[model samples]
Target: MADPSNELLASALSGEGQPSVVQLHGEESPQRCAELRWLYPAIKWWKALRLRGEEDLNGIDAYAASVDALLLDAWSPKQLGGTGHRLDPAWLERLEMRICRDLPWWLAGGISAEWVPTLVHQVSPFGLDASSRLEHSPGVKDLRRVEALVQAVRVNSGNRG
Candidate 1:
């Protein structure tokens, strides 16, 4: 939360092809999000939160109100991220589309080419995250599946407008 971490974020901000958005995918609270927003006003913060069950439904608004966007991912007892497990679609469904009006959000975890169309149309997230499952080994990705995922999103997004 100090120099080394922020220096990394700052370098990304100032480096070539600087990213317009960055993600904070930890156990940071809404107050922390607000603080970071103040610290780096130019950065678009996407706060990633894992959904454990139906009981967490109400807490979505707090995160949404705090950040530029929200990324709701599948929860696992062991992993912090990249669990390759999915949350119940019904849980995400209750978030409603209205939230996207002010701040776009994303869905992550266990997403694949097959579910892309349904997820794009039904859940209607601002974006999706596909990792873990796309990898053949720890860090080695199977490009074919990545292409398939991209193609699916393209096909489904075109249907939107």
Candidate 2:
């Protein structure tokens, strides 16, 4: 979930939480992300995913200083998230060198086994966010597909560990 309320995030962090990456999405500003981080210092904030075109990158880059990772997702006209659409690879390629260097960024938006390995090589994202492609329906992920994709990326990367 992206841009969750501060109360909800705080409650989740109150438990035995580990250092996890949280991707801020939706209409959240970098200032808001900073506020949430201040409210809960236990959680490590990752990149924020903006829906707008290249324009959103400015806000994202501004906030990137405080985050541990960056993620680029597709924008849609109908819904706020889970649009099952892929972002412009070229756009990511251009920004890959400038914004997220040395940061662990993940590529979201309908990634699959067939495309994940190639995109991983092209964009060189730290990982792939597989959601719609491995889902039997909306919000229901297919484990088999997910496992296959994990295997594929690992094999392609020659990462046996």
Candidate 3:
């Protein structure tokens, strides 16, 4: 969960290339999304929640109502992020698209350059997180890998659109 404080968020938002979305995780409540939206109407909010099983589906509506987008990360009881394992695509298969038709959603976990096209064709998520796959090691990104992944996403996105 990357819950940066408002001051921190303001600092980053002031920098070059203001991000279109900022994701909140863990103890960061959806109220923060409302606060941020009030403060900076230009950016959108994405709240990352861990998905375990069917029972967790109960709160999907409330969650979706609070943010512009949802980021479903694989549930790992022992960890916070980057489990290096993809959530079963079948998990998404059960969802009714009409439920969240207005809200965009994203997927996370072990996504790779090669998986982008297939995934885009399948779920057509609003976006994806490719950090773990683009890294040479934890916290250290490989520039070449990042570039290749970006190229792959662009090509695949064009194909999907």
Candidate 4:
């Protein structure tokens, strides 16, 4: 979730054990990340950046450096993720020679087994994050779809290997 209060983030980190992954979703601004830099050591930070348009290309290096990894997800000013919209692949293409050249990043939103090969070939992300695409309904996962996505990634990876 985005805009998590520092108190809540800290509480989650200190309670029981640290989460294996702590993603900051819909968080695109570097200043916001800088404000939360104190929590860096306590969590495995992964920033889920919303690709609104060309403007998002600004200051991406600082954003990438602030976290352990990056996730490039589709965004609409009207929605808070899981919008079932595809990000403009051209944005990723524009970035291929720049920020994407050395960052550990992933792609998310409206992803499915069929798109994996094309996306992998286009962006070469560290991974893929499937959400609404694998769901039978909001908050309900479809086991078969999930399994198929895994198989697709495995097969595609083997082919690439």
lDDT of 1 by residue, 8-59 (tens): 7667677578666778877888888877778778778788888888677676
Candidate 2 lDDT over residue span 16-73, tens digit each: 6444756676666667777877876766776547445765555456767566676778
Across 57-123, the per-residue lDDT of candidate 4 in tens digits comes to: 6667787656778887877788777777788776777776578456688888789988877766666
Superior by TM-score: candidate 1 or candidate 2: 1
Q: Candidate 4 versus the native: TM-score?
A: 0.85
- Residue 79 miss distance in model 3 (angstroms): 2.7
TM-score, candidate number 3: 0.71
**Candidate 3 Cα misplacement greater than 4 A, ranges:** 1-21, 27-43, 96-98, 158-161
Give residue 80's error in model 3 in angstroms. 2.0
- TM-score for each candidate, following the candidate numbering: 0.82, 0.79, 0.71, 0.85
Sorted by TM-score, highest first, which candidate order results? 4, 1, 2, 3
Cα RMSD of all models vs. native, in order, equals 3.3, 3.5, 3.8, 2.4
Task: State the TM-score for model 2.
Answer: 0.79
lDDT for model 2 comes to 0.71
Q: Write the per-residue lDDT of candidate 3 for residues 28-139, one digit (tens) a residue.
A: 6657666777888888888887778755555576756668888878888788778767777656655534347788878898888877777766667777876777788898
